[model samples]
Target: MWVPVGSMFSFIEVLPLVLLILDAMEHHSLIRKQQRFR
Candidate 1:
């Protein structure tokens, strides 16, 4: 299957934001768990 350049470019641009969001979520969850243990 052939993909359009614009679509591919957009996906690449958005990938980092998505990864950052996921990393932030994981960090938040870790903090919450640590607080609960106290």
Candidate 2:
């Protein structure tokens, strides 16, 4: 393969961190939505 395996592995390593950040952002938006209705 022309692509390096290390870069592919690095993306796998960073995947959870990216997901965690997305999850936090979604949670924060949901909280703000709840506050708006109150």
Candidate 3:
């Protein structure tokens, strides 16, 4: 399988962005749950 080097670098960059978005969504959900419980 052949992959472009530029695409590999872009994927690496986007991977962290995706993770950050997921982490932010999880954090927001947790905050909402805590606020509802309070």
- For candidate 2, the TM-score is 0.83
- Judge candidate 3 at residue 5 and give its lDDT: 83
Using TM-score, give the best candidate's number.
1
Off by over 4 Å in 1: 1-3
Selected candidate, larger lDDT, 1 vs 3: 1
TM-score to native of every candidate shown: 0.88, 0.83, 0.82
For residue 26, what is the lDDT in candidate 2?
A: 100
lDDT of 3 by residue, 1-38 (tens): 35698889999999999999999999999999999998
Which sections of candidate 2 miss by over 4 Å? 1-3
Query: How big is the positional error of residue 37 in model 2, measured in Å on the Cα after superposition?
Result: 0.7
Clashing residue pairs in candidate 2 (N, C-alpha, C atoms within 3 angstroms): none
lDDT of each: 0.95, 0.95, 0.94
- Total clashes for model 3: 0
lDDT of 2 by residue, 1-38 (tens): 64778889999999999999999999999999999999
lDDT of 1 by residue, 1-38 (tens): 34688889999999999999999999999999999999
Which order, best to worst by TM-score? 1, 2, 3
Candidate 2 lowest-lDDT run of ten? 1-10
In candidate 3, how many Å is residue 33 off?
0.3
